[model samples]
Target: MTKESTPNDVTLAEPIEQEVEAHSEDNKVSEQEKKKFEKREKERKHLVSKLAQGNMDHLLTRVASVLNHYQETRNSDITLQTRYWEVFQSDIYNGSVIDPKDMYKLERLTSIARARAKIQNEFKMFLADEEVQVSRRSRQETEKEIQLATKPEIPLISMYCDESGKTGNFAIVGSLWVINKARQTQVRDHFSKWKTEKGLSAKDEFHFTEMKKHQLDLYKEFFDEVIKNSDALGFKAVVVDKTKIKRPIDEIIMDLHYQVVHQGIEHEVSNGRLALPRIVNFFKDEEDGQEALYETKLKQHLHSQFRLAFDDQLTLDLFNSVPSFQNVYIQMADLYTGCISRVLNHPKQGEGNHKDHFAEYVLELLRLDLGAKNDQSQDFAMVHFFE
Candidate 1:
C-alpha cells in the first residue's frame, strides 16, 4: 500500500523539512527572549526592594508612585479595557481576573498611599526643623556660658545669718543674701537713712524681742523696705525640732547651716537666678556663748564643702563672725528667724501684743504657713523643718 519515493518527491519533501527546521529555530529564539524579559523584571523588583529598605519615608513614596501609575493608566476606558482583555488572554490571571469591584478597591488604596506618603514627607520635614531649632538653642547657650566664663573675676555675693530658739522646741537658723555690692550698699544706706529719720542712733539695736507694742508701725515700715528690695534679696531657713534630736544639737546646727547655704546657692544658680563661679562672703551673728574655736571650725568646714561641690570655680571669699547690732542686715536675719521660731515654738508667748501682731504680719508678707514646710520655685525663700 506504501509507494517508494522518487527523486522529484524527495526534492519537494526537502523544502518542507527546511521550513519546519526554520520554524523550530524561531520558537527557540522566542523562548530565550521571554526568559530574558522575566529575569529583567525580577531584577527591577529586587532593585526597588533594596532601595526601600530601612527607610519608611522612601518606601511609602515608592508605593504611592506605583499606585498612582496604575490609577492613571486605568483612568482611560480604552486602556482599561485593553489590559482587561490582555489579562484574560494570558494564563497569568487564570480564571479570576480583577473585576470592577477590585478596581474600585485599588483606587481607594492608591488614595490612601498618596495621603500616607504626603504625611511621611511632612513629618520628616517637621523632625528636621526640630533638630535645627535644638541646635540653635544649644549654640546660644554655649555662647552665654562663654560670656560668663570670660569675666575678669567671679561676682562677689554676701550672706548674713542669724539663729534663734536654740534652747526651745524648734531651733531656727535664717539667712539673708545680698547678691551684689550695689544692692548691699543700697540696703545699708536705706536702713541708715530710715534710722536717722526715726531719731535712732547708729548703735541702736532693732531686736525683735525688745520691740514694744507702740513700735509696731515702725517695724512694719522697716519691713516694707525689705519687701521692696526683694529683687536683690533672698532668704532661706532651716528649722530643727529639738524633740527629734539623735545627734548633738551643736553638730546638727553646723551641718544644717552648710545644707541651707549650699542648697540655696545650687538652687539659685540652676534656676538662672544666680551665675556660676561666684565668690560668697559669709557673715554670721557672733556666738559669744559657744566654744572659743567654734567660728573657725565652722568656716573651715564650709570651705571644705564648697571645694568638694564646685572645686575652685566657687570660692569662699570671706567668713567672719560679726555683732548683729552693728549690722542692720544681720539684725534683719535675726528678726526674720526670731519671728519664725516664736510662731512655731511659742505663738502664745506675747499673745495680743505687738510681737504677736508683727509675727502675723511677717507671715502674711512672706506667704509662709508655719506648720507646713514651705519651699517654692517661683519665690526665693525656703523654710524647711527637719522633724
Candidate 2:
C-alpha cells in the first residue's frame, strides 16, 4: 500500500519504538543487578553471624575445659586440645578470616593434643610425688619422735595488717592464731570479749588523721592482750608490709624480731627462737610514675612474693625442708590506694569519684570479667563445658 508520507510521522515512528525498547532493557538490567547485590549482602551478613556464633561456642567450650582440668588437677600448666587451639588462634587471637584448610593442620593438631595430654599426665605425677613425699616426711617425724622425751609444739601466728596512707595515716593491725583446739577457742573468746568491751567495729577510713587514731587504739589493745598471754603461748614472727611505716622499716623489722625472742623466753617454749619473716616490699623508682609502670611493678612484686611464699624452692631449701603453704600473701597496696593518692594530689579532675571507677574497671579486666553481664555469660559458658 502507498501510504501518505507525513514528514512528522516518518521522523517520529522508528526512533520512539527503539527508545522504548532500550529503556525497558535498561530497567531489566538494573533490577537484575540490584537482586545480585542484595543476595551477596545477605550472604555476607549470614556468614558473619554464623562465624561469630561458632567462635563464641568454641571459646566457651575451650575455656570451660581448661578451667575444669585446672580445678581437678590444681595445675596451672593445663592446655587446650589442637582443634580448640586452632579455633582460638583463628577466631579469638588472630581475628582473621580463616579458610577450611587453615583450620586443620594435621601435625599442629597432633602436637596440641599431645601437649594437653602431657600436661595432664605431668600434673597427675606431681600430685603423686607430693603425696609420697608427705608420707615419707610423716614417717621420718615418727622416727625422730622416738629419740626425744617430749615433742615440742610448733608455734605459729597469722597476722593481717594494713596501712592507710604512706606517710600521714595509721595502720590497722588484725591478728589471728593457728594453734591447738583449746588455744583457738580461748583466743576467739578473748577477741569476742574485747570487741564487746571496746565496742570496736571494723570500719575502713581514708582520712589519715582518723585512721591513725583508730589503728593506734587497735594496736594497743592487741599488744596488751598478747603481753598478758605471753606466758602461756609462744610468739612467732610478724607478717607485715614494709611500705608506709610510721617508724623506720628496719626498726620495725628488728622490733618484731625482738618481740618474738622476748615472748619465747617468757613462755620458756624453746631454746633457739628464730624469726621467720614474710616481708612485702615493692620496687620503687622514678619510672614508676605511669600507669603501665605501676602495673608492671605490681605484677613483678606479686609474682616474686608468690614464688617466695608458695613455690617449692624457697620453702624446701631455705625453710629446712618445710613444705610450701598453698595460701599466698596478697599486698593491700591496690588501685584503691592509688585512687586515694590521685584524689589527694589532684582534686580538680573529679579524681575522687572517677579514680575508683577506673580502678574497678582495671580490676574487672584483670579478672576477665568486664561486667556483670560478662560474668553471667561466662558462668553459662562454663556450664556448657561440663555438659
Candidate 3:
C-alpha cells in the first residue's frame, strides 16, 4: 500500500522494456521464450484496448484530479516559475511518498496544468467582457426612461378677448393667445408690479384712452416686452362694419364673436399647433342688456359647431367666459380693441389731433392687420378686419 515500498515501484515504462530484454534468452531464441513473448504482447494489446473503450471514465477522473491540483498550485497573477517556487515547493501530492520517477511525473503534470490554465483564463475574460457589455446596455435604457418620465407633457394656450365700440357702431373684438402658464404669469406679474408701483386703484380699469402720459409709458414698456417675446404669443382682431349687416345688435355681436373664434381655430389648425387640450377664451362678458343671453346662445352655437367648423374632435372645448379686470390678459385684450377701434372708426378725425396716430403704436405692438389671412403665414400673429 505504501508508494515507495511497493513491488511495482519501478517506472511503468521500465518494466515493459525489462520484459522484452528477458524474453530474448539465447541468440537463436527458444520456443518457450517465443511463447512468453507472444503472451506478454497479447496482454499489452488487451490492456490498451480496454483503456481506449472501458477505462475512459477512469482516465477522465485522473485528468480532472491533475487539473485541480495544478490550479491549486498556480495563480494567474504570478508567473509559472514564481508560482511553483512560491506556492508548490513544500506541497505533497495527496500526502503520498515521492521518488525519482515522481519528479518526472510532476514535471509533466506542470506542463499540462499550464495549458489548462491558459484556456480557462480565456473563458474567464470572455465572461467578464460580456458582463460589462450588459451593464452598459442597462444604463443606456435607464437614461432613456428617465428622459421620458421628466419631459413636460403639453403646454397651454390662453385667449383673452374684449370688444370695443357699441354693437350699432363699428365694433372690434380683439383676442390675444398667451402661450403657456409661465408666459401668462410673467405678463400678469409685470402688470401687477407696475400698477402697484404707480399707486393705481385696483378697481380702476386699465382703459388705454384714460391712461395719462406716464401711464402710457408704463403700458408701452409692457407692450414692448410682449412684442419682444411675440413668438410666444398670438394676437387676433376683428372689426365689424354694422352698415353691412341688418341683424339686431345682439345678433351681430354673436356673429362677430363666432367669426373671431372660427378664425382663431382655423389659424391654429392650419399652423399644426393643436397639441394642447383646449383653447381657453376669456371674453369681455358684459352682463347688461341681452349680452348674457347672446353669450349663452353663442356658447351653444360654438359647442355644437366647433368640431364641425374645424373638423377636429381631439381638441378640447373653447372656454368662453367673463374675466374681471384682475385678469391682466383680459385687460391686454381690452387695450387692443380700444386702440383698433380708434383707427377704424375715426380715420380722418385724428388727422389734426396730436394723439391721432396712436393706432400706429397698436399695430407695431400687435403686428395685426384687419384683412390679411395667410395659410402658411410667416407672421406669428393675425389681425382680421371683418366688415
Lowest lDDT block of 10, candidate 2: 378-387
| Candidates by lDDT, descending order | 1, 3, 2
Q: Candidates 1 and 2: which is better by TM-score?
A: 1
Q: Write the per-residue lDDT of candidate 1 for residues 1-387, one digit (tens) a residue.
A: 999989999999999999999999999999998887687655444432322111123434333222222222212223223233332233333234666644543323444434433432432211113443345245355454344333344566678888877678887788888775446656677778889999988888777888888888988888887888888788888887778887787787787778778777876786677887776767787766877587778888899998998888677755666666547778888788878877877766535678878887976788887756455333766677666
lDDT of 2 at 182: 26
For candidate 3, what's the RMSD? 38.2
Instruction: Report clash pairs, candidate 1.
Output: none
lDDT of each: 0.64, 0.32, 0.52
Off by over 4 Å in 2: 1-157, 163-185, 198-223, 230-271, 274-387
Give lDDT tens digits, candidate 2, residues 56-88.
Answer: 233323433332222222122212332244334
User: TM-score of each candidate?
Assistant: 0.58, 0.24, 0.51
**How far off is residue 103 in model 2, in Å?**
61
How do the residues 42-103 of candidate 3 rate in per-residue lDDT, one tens digit apiece?
A: 54333323211112233322332222223322222122222333223335333235666556
> Distance (Å) between predicted and true CA of 140, model 3?
34
> How many residue pairs clash per model?
0, 0, 1
| RMSD, every candidate, angstroms | 34.3, 24.6, 38.2
